[model samples]
Target: MILHGIGLVLLAVVTGTLSVLLAMALIRWWDAGRGTRGMQLPQGLDSSLKPMVLLYRDQRLVDATAPARALLDRLSVPEDEWARLLQWIGPRFPEAMEGLARIDRSGRFECLGQSGTGSATLRLLVEQVDSGLLRITITDPQAEYAGIVVDSMSQQAMEEELDLLRRSLDQTPMLVWRQDAEERVTWANAAYLRKAEGQTDEPIGWPLPRLLDSPRPVPGAGTRTRRASLNQNGAVFWYDCHSHPVGDQVMMFALPADAAVRAERSLREFVQTLTKTFADLPIGLAIFDRQRHLQLFNPALIDLTNLPTGFLTARPTLFDLLDKLRELRMVPEPKDFRSWRQQMSNLESSAATGHHVEEWSLPGGQTYRVTGRPHPDGAVAFLFEDITSEMSLTRKFRAELTLGHAILDNLGEAVAVFAPGGQVVMSNRAFRDLWPGADSLGHALACWQNQPETGPGVDALGARLTQPDADLRDSGLMASPQGQLLGWSVARLTGGRQMVRFRLPDPAQQGGSQPLLAASAG
Candidate 1:
């Protein structure tokens, strides 16, 4: 009885100690549940922890945190619908459930999802915890991959298009260039460099404004201006430049002025057409310098003067042609020709008038209606037309009207008649006046006529019989007793006889040189 009683007392002591240890363990576990920072969870226990979720089903989704409400609104799901989603999500939730199962079995899951009109992917995971419920994680993989693809495609297309644009720009004829916001040239085509035309030894990368003495201003983001330049050789050109903001740089496009080129070409064509129109005109056109040197002579002038075409190129002086005229007996005399040419040349140099028109006595003894026009640069133009045929017609008309006898006897025009033997048969009042009572009528023509046998009158008569258009004039002493100075002319009458004219000095000046004589004998 005493041994059994001792064992029972020891058992009571052991049982009491076990109860005290159990109570302490329960208190410590409760403290850990309240989250003691010092307590470390086991590895497998982390999968069981759950976030503390506060549910308020009656509250509007708008009342939730911005992020949470935004996510819900994007899905077009209301708060009540989400709160009661367990029944409505029967179909779509299966896919989410399957993904969760796989995550629980393998610690991670990846699956695709179709949300509204778009598609997505989910990477869900269930993490283990030491003491809490399981954690469910979801992420979208489709959105991430889609963003990467879009960025890659945009970069590739941009590079391809830029390559094509660069090639096209190089092939263009006009210069093209681009500049940064700071007005620094960033790029240019091959034609852009060619415009420099090797004059510039340095590379062309600086701003265009820096190259000119006066550059146009480039205002920022407003109205713009452009201008053109002329080359050293009198060539015209154009440039168009603009400035605008483009990201961190200013974009500028420069091109030569094509419109200016077209305008110039059109103007040149117009001038060419005008010159061509006048080239074939009928009247003689001649251009002369201040020294009476012929600068230009149209085809008509060449033919009328019997001048060689080469004379047009060399532009000979009036004296040159006058010398030839003297040799041909076309001038009254070489001295007279020289004097008259000098007078015309002097008139041109003095700029006596801006323009004038008058009759010209050609060395050939032809009367030409001429127009003289003066230019600011000391150049002159002479236009002429022959009126000899018109004068002949006028005389013929007078003869038909029975006015020839009256004109021959009373007209102030000097007149003389030559018999077949070269004797003077009759003379007019004007002719007697010129000789101052000299007995010319019914006398030998050689007594008063100047160089009766070998003078301008003889030469003119010979040419008139052979050549349809012929003339002569000369200054020489008369073949008379006194050898007086005389100017003479000869023409064929309608009946085929010869009518002559003689202009002599008055008796008051018979022994003196005549005042500067100006006469036309044709």
Candidate 2:
């Protein structure tokens, strides 16, 4: 009986100790749920009942209600929650940051947000719960009580989209930034920060440095684009900057333009070189574009055509330039103005397909050989060359040749000139009649040797004519197959040539076998 009673007492003591420990645990938990650093809420407000409330310890997020956590999770930034939250809120409520800065001294502050279409007015309440803890409360009194509910699939898709946008902005080579009305840089992408810092490994701070210097302020409406340059570590980098206004601020983008700038400079230098070359040319050059407008003209063109520099500089059309030339009497005169225009049109059409040349005889007795050639891209180039001296020399040569031929025809004796190669160089009319078809020296010799009435002297005549250096003159008398006495002689002329002559003996010396005196006289 005594042992059973001892067991019942021990059981009662154990049960009482268990009940006391359970009560202490409940009290500690209740106190922890109230707030941090012994903070107490107002009589009618409960933290669990509030939809949007965030608790921060210094720069780190300690806890947040369901709706507040959802909002912070939607922000796509590499920064901590506090920084991301501030960035989103500072742009909309500019004074909010200022209020938070003074929160320590004032203990608490409230900011009223502007209401928009289908949205309630926001109320932001920031309080310093303790030295190291801060509480931010966001509320909308006119909003209905609705739960922040999102399906798993929808949440995943939104997260993926946000990640893509964030990655794109960070990885793009272009520099991008946002600025407020006061010209303070509020946000910048990774590329912008890297260039602004210039090879520094230091962490980027808020309010990024401005790299582009604009002469004028960014316009408020429509996009404004301009060329800008940045100097980094003594190296100059060029960019084409574009700015667009977003509400009261501006968004700027800078695209690399170094290659474009270099290409444009090279083209300008090439054009200048060509212009200098054309300026020094002797031939008058005029180049017309596909539209037939005069695009380029050389100084020689002005001197040759006698057109004023001011007139040519005006870039006249093809017809207009031709009309000006007509007025100056630089081109050949046509019967009428209409025919002249049609002729010029034909000249342009012909030049487009191939080379076209026309000779212009001016009133001043100057002749110009005008040549038109096709250029690349449907352009045409005209070259004017003065040919008056050339034409005069050609006419003089033709006249001399005519007079010489006339003198040769009047000769009474038949004459043939042979080149060093024994081919006939020239034959006069008398020679052609005497030796009806002897076109060469060999043929003429054959005709003479075949004659039955010819003497043995014919072979000696042939040998002398064939010798290029046989300077000694030879003469002989022979009878033609037609029963006429003929005299023939061979003489060497200048330039290694032989001149052979055949003539009928004079009536006074016809009967003598003594080689006719007529041959000796020749």
Candidate 3:
């Protein structure tokens, strides 16, 4: 009987010890579960594959992984009650909120959200707990789309945007095309077809490098522009292609530049012709564009300005040209450099008016006439003409006239010359001494004042002498205003010029000669 009692006691001790251990273990497990909200953290989740964030029923942050925090910056949540938070999300993610109001229901949603970082397309999973708490979870990307069809506004928006972009690309003036990684043309716009159909209609399915004489602007270059030329139907065309890479494919936009190329060629030819024409011109030609840069110059410019050949071909500015000229003593030297700079600017500005004329007396005893005239498209042209001969001849003519007057001053008798019109051609100092108040040269004969009041005045006599059929009475003797007998004789000279001379007899023999001639005649 005692053995049976001891066996029951041993059984009781074993049961009590087992009960305590079980209770301790249950308490430890419950304590651990309290911190984790009674849910296992899904042992060893692939965090690298997808970030995750969990929310409590109280709308408090429960836990988040590394990438989850970065993504949460994009998901805006109002700091309010859990119900209100769910309501706020309901409008934007109505599908995600279907079971949000209930703790026992489960729901899933995908949405596009905006935050500081940019746009974020995310997914939300809502799960219920036995403790009446909501377990909200977030993942960056949802599972692959299955049989359940879900269309969102973001998807519609992307499709509409893509459609609009396609339309815009078609309407654009440039020829937009896409090429595969092999550099073969796959698709093209209408502009590309219009340009490529010049000789043939097969642009697609052709390699871009074959169509061009040279493909790629530079080898091993990144996305950039290249000028390409093609010959089709006996015509050459040019295109400036803008290229960029789009994931193993190249997107190219070709701009039509054939007209621009032709225009440039025509301009080049025209410039050559102008150069040839200006080569033969005797005048120096220098043309400056609107920007005040020397564009065109002729050989005569070098000869006139004494500038070096290389200096002109170097494409110098107007100011630079002036500075060099001043250095070479070719142009007028400026007293002050600062003031001359301003003056130089003014000269160029005014030269565009096309009416500027200036004379430059160079240091080499030469004179130059510089003229500036405006040309097409706001250009200025300077022409230098040598006028040294013209100036020298003018000076010589004046000197000879002065010398002739000096010689006439030493004469004794008074002399006068008249043209066919009775106008006094010239009168010298001898004539002026004979008649103190006689009219100067070119004086009219109709208004003589200091002559004798005979022969119907000097004007009538001169008129009769010059008449085609007048009495040849161009010579006669007349008394001066002082009652002196002056024997005047008029005779015709060369060039339709007539001369008048006065005779002053010897004072000792004049009275006896008159009476002797009279007695011999009797």
How close is each model in CA RMSD to the real structure?
25.8, 19.6, 14.9
Please, what are the lDDT tens digits per residue for candidate 1 over residues 243-349? 45555555444556768778888999997785676577767787777777887666776555566677567877766764664555443342565676776565454
Candidate 2 lDDT over residue span 244-301, tens digit each? 8888888889998999999999999999999999999888999999999999999999
TM-score of 1: 0.29
For candidate 2, the TM-score is: 0.52
Which has the better lDDT: candidate 1, or candidate 3?
3
User: Which prediction has more favorable lDDT, 2 or 3?
Assistant: 2
Task: List candidate 3 segments past 4 Å from native.
Answer: 1-164, 171-173, 195-198, 201-223, 284-297, 301-364, 368-385, 400-522
lDDT of 2: 0.79
Q: Report lDDT (Cα) of residue 467, candidate 2.
A: 64
Q: Candidate 3 lDDT, tens digit per residue, 160-234?
A: 567778788778877788877666788887666666676566563454333542234334577687788877788
TM-scores for the candidates: 0.29, 0.52, 0.45
Task: Order the candidates by TM-score, highest first.
Answer: 2, 3, 1
lDDT against the true structure, each candidate: 0.52, 0.79, 0.65
